[model samples]
Target: MDPQVTLGERERRTWAAFVTMRRDLEGALARDLARDGLSVSDFEVLARLDQAPGGEMRARDLAAAIGWDKARLSKHVTRMVARGLVERREAAEDGRGQVVVLTTGARQVTAAAVPNHVAAVRRHFFDLIEPDELDVLDRVLTRINARAVEG
Candidate 1:
């Protein structure tokens, strides 16, 4: 084993804490979204589509944005389509590519979900964090994300 590959006591504790915090945070959000009849993945997809120009984005682009593989995205999109949350149509600019568009139902649900989701986030996270701590977190996460992409 490489000497540098070993984690110190502090590093191990930090990693464990990070994993637990993320899992708990995600679980809380999932539960909150479920109360609105949506899954966490559904909220993520709809939120991204709602923010995209024309409230639509190419399927591949959506997958990339969400860090999911095309197959996974396709399956999710299929389910959303069946539930009337989204529609898949040929991309206007690129007929060869498919795009996912938010449906009217999706818009209404997304709009309603946002306020509750924000409240949940604030209650679980923001209310406990100082403004300065948020800034520090942003910087730390940004740097970590950059380093992750480098690999």
Candidate 2:
């Protein structure tokens, strides 16, 4: 291992804490979304579709946006389509490409779930951190994400 690469005691502790926090946060959100008959993945897909232009995005683009592989996205989209949450359409500009479009039902489900999800996030995560801490945390996470993508 590189001499400067090994984690020190503080770094180890910080990494462990961050991992635990993220796991617990995701668990909480998953539970909240499950109560509404949706998984975290489902919520994410719907949310992304809702935000896209015309509430639709090419299947490949959606996969890229969510960092999921094509096969994984296809499976998720298949399930969502069965649940009446979304529909697949042939991309107008690309004969071979398909798009996933959010259904009205999906829009309604997301509209309802988002407020509750936000409240849960505020209660479980944001409320525990001070405003200054939040700012620092955001900056740190942003830099970490940037470095990760660069690497």
Per-prediction TM-score, please? 0.94, 0.94
For model 2, residues 2-114, the per-residue Cα lDDT tens digits are: 85979988999999999999999999999999888899999989989988999999999999999999999999999999999999999999588899999999999999999
RMSD of each: 1.3, 1.4
lDDT score for residue 126 of model 1: 95
Backbone clash numbers for all candidates listed: 0, 0
Which residue pairs collide in model 1, if any? none
Assess the local accuracy of residue 20 in candidate 1 as a C-alpha lDDT between 0 and 100.
Answer: 98
Per-residue alpha-carbon lDDT of candidate 1 for residues 12-97, written as tens digits (9 for 90 to 100): 99999999999999999999999999999999899999999889999999999999999999999999999999999997775898
Tell me the deviation in Å of residue 122 in model 2. 0.8
Model 2 CA deviation exceeding 4 Å by range = 1-5
